[model samples]
Target chain A: MNGKEFWIYLAILAGSTYLIRAIPFAAVQKKISNVYVRSFLYYIPYTVLSAMTFPAALYATGNVVSAAAGLGVGMVFAVMKKGLTVVALISCVTVFVTDLILKQGI
Target chain B: MKQFLRGVRNGVPIGLGYLSVSFTFGIMAVSAGFSWWQAVLISMTTLTSAGQLAGINIMTVPGQYAEMLISQLTINIRYSFMSVSLSQLTTAEFKGIKRWLLGFFMTDEIFAVAACQREVSTKFFAGLAVMPYIGWTLGTLAGSLLGNVLPESVMNALCIAIYGMFVAIVAPDAKESRSLLAVVAVSVGLSCLFYYTPILKELSSGLAISVCAVVAALLGAFLFPVKEEASHER
Candidate 1:
């Protein structure tokens, strides 16, 4: 919304995020006994990253084609276990090149 | 001093990683109508890419405070688990304001690095957290400010960097673990379903993502459970 609302929303988000991490650090003294919970937590990072990546990445570029190209190059780099910065730079550059090509119609 | 320096050194790569992603976030934030200062402030306050993006998405629609809270809570809930896991590794003597401060800065990258250690010190963790914090905030500042001057085409393409970062994070794990591969496929498939299906597509992106991630993760846990491993420090 407005300026006030934005700050308030940020505050709510920051406070909630703070509580999420702080409560565990403040309260959880021992390793979790629950294997199910541990396993679930273990998988959260991978699944969440994947969920965020797929469709969202497709839409991030100017068009789906360029985005797909970027994604392809990115996946290739990632599967090869390239560093994060290298993968990101190559993907973005690929998207830029693909976008230019698609626009020029050459 | 050495421990803190080691933490700082270890955090350098993470900080560099954050720089690129938060730069993309900066552009997203400005495009969504937030000022550069506001974008940087959000990064400074939250230090969470997913939660901040979700919050920004909620902001775009307006009048969805409850949705904002739920989205942030769900997206950030993983950090709670990470904190719990890291707590087991932290020194028992660490507590009070220091604990709170470190906890606030315990982001995904920080936790991943810190957790790998046999033991963690407050100084080391602080050093580890500060570099990334500065990197994230500065990157947002650079993005929000520089993004305004950049051409539309360049900015659009640059946005792919964030996505690339996410893929880089997950692809290695998926390649190594069949269970993680399944989890990635399930999450991606569910996300696509949510995006394409008429009724499911009605859900906000934040909610859709959380649902996909949670469901896929639960299924993965059931199908391929992680065997318990002995801890070096605990």
Candidate 2:
């Protein structure tokens, strides 16, 4: 892709993304007062994170086995109260080693 | 300045997590034949994983600009929900420019950390956004320049790093609160249902995530409504 058309498409991509994000900031300047609505809003970050994790995490590597291995290790570290970076690095390392060992046919 | 530094401290981990994820994106965009600078540009401007991934596909073919707009909108719509939630968390401190700037940079991990805070000051959010933005762009630079030299196993392993960060963020809280646990379970279940069922599986990832999140949140709000004093507020 090149020329004016390419940049135009790029603008479309960037502009739409920016608008989707920026509109809410521009629109919702006040805290919501309803208990149910507030609670739902409060719960969104967690639910969104959770929905993004499972099944997707299981498919993140060469195969579900290694991915699940990483997820299992991640769960252990998370349960141990490790911070975000630690859990992520540990999980990455686990998948790395598991994939390596599996590759070695041992 | 102290608060800004604290935000930076909190953001460093998110920045580190972003490196692996954006490294993957960098490798992908380069391997797909886009210029390294173009890959970096996409990362810098878009600041989204799923959306950028979709945009790469859209841009690969010439004259797919219509698809470009549609895919970006479909893939990134989740940010609207996140931003609305974040608006409630922000204090009166953020003004037009800061909020607009922050909106441009908002990503999943940044939202996770920022929304957890009792107050989100402009400087703090700015501090939090900086490293992830830098790491994202630099990681793309590295990946496009060096991804093939890196082993496939390592790349595959690194791909899981962001998901690991998600687990890290969500697990401890779920462990503490039964309501949160229920919400997580419901979301995971719906995610699987959407992933595996024939018709349901056809839903785009952005839409699927939004549906699962909204449904799970509804479960929590209706079943275990939080006290007004309980949720984060300034």
Candidate 3:
């Protein structure tokens, strides 16, 4: 796109993004007095993150084996209470290596 | 001075992480025919994995405005929750303009770090925010400019950074409670369902994953409610 078109496109994109982000703050500013709504809001992040991470780790490459390997390594490290950096390294390395070996028939 | 150093120290790992993931985003944007400046600009504004991913998807599909909006909205809806949760964590003095300014810097990594702190001055948090903000923006610029230099395998490896970040976030909480274990388990299970179920496969990946997480978390919470601590006598 040219400069004018690009700017227009970006403006719309930025506006939409800012709107979504600004909504909760806007709602709070309005002084919504609902305890149940507030409680639901508190749990949204944990649920959203879980949903994002879970499925991909499970069905990567259409095979349970690879997913299992990744999850296994991740869970073990997680259970051992390793730090985020450590668990991430172990899980990814495990999946990458296992995927390589499985693909190579080694 | 000390706060600035602490910001720098905390920011280094996150900055390194951003370099890897944002590089992939940069490369993807360039490959999709976005200009270097455009890619950099997008990174500067969004500074989010899901948002960037959605942006790429929208760019790829010509004239799909509705699809693009929904895609971006779904992916970013989590931020609303992050914002709400974090609102409580801020000090009473951080009302009005300061809250809005701090809101801009509210991100998953920043929130995780801030949540762990017992009590920190808003100035320290602001200082902390500046480093990652600059690092993420610069990382994207560098990545966009350096497009296609790295091999695909290396790029694939870099995608693991977010997962690493998640592991870091969940590890502390998981260690502390069995209930959190249920949350993780249910999340994994729900993810599997979305991946394997043929009908659900038609839904967008972002939506599928997000729905699974919300459902799993609600189910887990209901099944294993957190027990209240014993009340102390007045």
Fnat per predicted structure, each in turn: 0.79, 0.86, 0.30
Clashes in model 1: which pairs?
Answer: none
Q: Estimate each model's TM-score.
A: 0.77, 0.95, 0.78
Clashing pairs in 2: none
Segments of candidate 1 deviating more than 4 angstroms = A1-10, B1-39, B49-71, B81-99, B106-128, B142-147, B229-234
Candidate 3 residue lDDT tens string, B34-93: 888998888777667667766765766556667666777776665666666555445555
Tens digits of per-residue lDDT, candidate 2, A5-78, equal: 65776688889999999988878887789999899988999999999987888988868989999989999899
Worst 10 residues of 2 chain B by lDDT: B225-234
Predictions: Cα RMSD each: 4.1, 1.8, 4.5
List candidate 3 stretches off by more than 4 Å: A26-43, A57-82, A86-106, B1-8, B60-67, B112-121, B220-234
Q: What is the lDDT, from 0 to 100, of the residue B15 in candidate 1?
A: 79
**Candidate 1 residue A38 C-alpha distance from true site, Å:** 2.7
Query: Which docking category, incorrect, acceptable, medium or high, applies to candidate 3?
Result: acceptable
True contacts kept of 3: 0.30
Q: What does the lDDT read for residue A37 in candidate 2?
A: 89
Query: Candidate 2's residue-wise lDDT over B66-115, tens digit each?
Result: 77888787778788989988998887988577788789977888999898
